[model samples]
Each structure stands twice: as C-alpha cells, then as structure tokens.
Target: MSTPQLLMIEDDARLAQMVGEYLTQSGFGFHHALDGASGLEMLQQRSPDLVILDLMLPDTDGLEVCRRIRAMPSNALAKVSVLMLTAKGDPMDRIIGLEIGADDYLPKPFEPRELLARIRAVLRRRGEGGSDAAPAAVMRFGTLEIDRNARTVTVGGMAADLTSYQFDLLVAMAERAGRVLTRDQIMEAVRGRELEAFDRSIDVHMGRIRAAIEVDAKNPKRILTVRGVGYVFAKQQD
Candidate 1:
C-alpha cells in the first residue's frame, strides 16, 4: 500500500512546521499551505488522501473551504477526507465544520499524539469498505445499492454523492438494517469510539447521507428517525 499523504492548511507557521515534522516522522507524506487558497490549490494538485484543515484561516473560512471541497467537480477530489482543527471552546465551529462535510475535528492545544490518532482513525474508517466477514461486495435494498468494493452508492442506478466518512456511516447502518441504533451505538459501530455526549456530528453526517440517497431529504424514506431514540436504515427502502 502507498503511504498516506496529508496536507495541513494552517496559518501559524511554527505550528504547521511542528506538525509537519511530527507527521513526517510518523511515516506520512506531509505538506502545508499557509492559507485556504493555497491549501485548495495544493489539494487539486497533490490529491492527498486526507486534509488537516484549521478552522480559522486568514483568507477563507475553513468551513467554506470544506464546502467547496465537497462541491468539487471531480468525484475523487470531492470525496477526499477532511479532518478539521478548531480552537478550544469553539464547539460551534466544530459542528459547522462537520455539517459542511468535514470527516472529523480536533481542538487546538492538542497533543501531537492525539492528532496522529485522530488522523489514523479517519483514514482507517475511510479505507474500511468492508471486512472479510462481510456478506457481499454489494448490498442492495430496494432501489438503493451500496457497493463495498467500489466504495460507492447508487439509488435507482444513479450515483449518490457521499464523503468518505458519510459513506462509512451509511455502510454501518445499512449493514445493520432494521435495528434501531442510538447515536453512541452508531459511532461505536463505525469508529469503535463512543459518541461524545454533546457531539451531534453523527446526526450531521446522517442528514448529508439522507440528502444524497433519499428522493426527498425532508422526508427521508431510506434512513428513518426513531423519534426520541436514534435512527434506523429501512430494510424496505424505496
């Protein structure tokens, strides 16, 4: 397997340098851009496996950058994983980042080890299309089809756009269709970590998925909300 490449879009030169060095030593190909424009340019040019984006940039907002990334014309680039870095106590920024398609977030003033772990976790989930024990390469439910080997989803033979993180969440829920899963259960199913009590990132991703797969996101038919609980992937999807 090729070494995973990472691009960090951060304005703090000293912090970017330290992170670059640390990630480099940890066996990753690391690159840095001082601002969002340069970062987006580098993203198109290098096509890194994942982006480590700082929430605050001098030129463009990190959330906007994430939105633009998700809107890219090329499917490969649009689906690239993004892990955002936000300031401490800025929970709203983190939530906004996720709402706009960021895969994960780590707060500022974090240990390099923790950052490394988060990076690995995001990449791991992206690559885990399905395990050997998985039943089939493609899972179908009515008009919705999930191709594990291709890492793609289609509804009524039309492609469904989904970020890597969102795709994994969909797969997790689809695999356990008919079960009512709580937020924590869904998070643990995807990444082996319990959901943080206050974190609504999973719900954000689910909304994105429903928008992509459901004909009408406002009244989703594929993934249903089990009011007062969590959600369920309808075994009988239309």
Candidate 2:
C-alpha cells in the first residue's frame, strides 16, 4: 500500500523539523509549510491525505486557514483529514478546531509517540475495514441529523457546534441506536482506544454532546445513562 501523504503547517523551525523527521521514520510521505499562506497554497495545489496544522503561523491565522480549507470545493478536500496542532491547550481552542472542521486536535508539548498514535488512529477511523460499518453517509434521529460526508450535525435544521470528541461520541451511539453501551465500550468505539484512569474525559464530552443535541441536557431523552452501565441512544420506535 502507498504511504499516506501528510502536510505539516508549522512555523517553529526546530519543532517542525523534529516532527517531520519522526513522521518520515514512521513511513509517512510528508511536506512542510512554515506559514499559513504557503500552507494554503500547498493545499490547493497538492491535495494530501491529512494535515497537521499549527495555530500560530507567519502569514495567515490557522483558524482562517481551517475555514478556507473547509470552504474549498468538496473535490479539493473530500478525502483530506485535518489534525489541528497548537500550543493552546484550552478546551475552547479544541472546540473551535472541531467547529471549523478539523478532524482532530493535539495540543503542543505533546510526546512524539502520542502524536503518531493520534495520526494513525484518525487515519484508521477514516480508512476502510473498521469494526463498525463506516458511520452512515447520513444519520437521522428526530430533528438531529449527522452527515458523515460533510462531517456536520444539525439540530432542528440548524447547525450544531460540537467538539470532535463530542461528534465522535454521538455518532458512535447513534449508529447503534437502541443499544446500551457501557462507558468503556463508548470510549473504545469513539476514541479508537481503551480508557485509562481519570478517563472522566468521556463524561465531559458526553455532557457537551447532550447539551448540543438534547432539547434538555439536564434531562436528556436521546442519550440516556443507564444506572450501572454506560449510555444508550433511545430513538423513539414507530
């Protein structure tokens, strides 16, 4: 199989070089751009399988770059995945990246091994032969609709802003509507990995998702939490 092509847009010379080297050694084909404008140009000229984008850039803002990339014709970014790389560890920053269409977010000061694992996980989730059938091309439950191709969710016909984790969690549950999924199962399916201690991260994400999709987050109807198990997607039966 051909190596996956990656585009890295980062202004930090030393860090960029180090990351590039790591990715190279991992058998990935990649190119680097030091500024946002050049990165955008490269994106338009040469489509890549994935992008590792930094928030701080010389020419253009990373958020703007993400917006522009998402605005590009589907033919341009149809199969491309974006992983936002930033020094900002703020929860809001992560939320914004996902809202702007990034597929994943990795804060800076991260271990190279973790970065590689995240990249591989994102690719695996998007690639063929996963455990579950690819999330539906379009999944609808009540007024909530999820479009996997568009990577978007809408509630009552209005677009709902969701973090990447929140979107993944909702999709995981919605795909298997009416089934109760344990917390561990939910984490495994959505995160593509096992959970560790202090993994209440999933609970936080689930809360956010419920707020976005549930008419009443305090008393959610769709995402029901079972007493001893995890949660369930209670789609009303006809």
Best of the candidates, lDDT? 1
* lDDT of model 1 at position 70: 92
**Residue 34 deviation, candidate 2, in Å?**
0.9
> What is the per-residue lDDT of model 1 for residues 107-155, given as tens digits with 9 covering 90 to 100?
8888999888888888877773223433458999988889986888999
Stretches of candidate 1 off by over 4 Å are 128-136, 192-194
Q: Estimate each model's TM-score.
A: 0.93, 0.69
lDDT of 2 by residue, 31-88 (tens): 9999988897898777887889998788877888888887776544744778888787
Residue 94: error of model 2 in Å? 1.5
Report the alpha-carbon TM-score of model 1 versus the true structure: 0.93
lDDT of predicted model 1: 0.87
For all candidates, the clash counts are 0, 0
Cα-based lDDT at residue 134, candidate 2: 57
lDDT of each: 0.87, 0.77
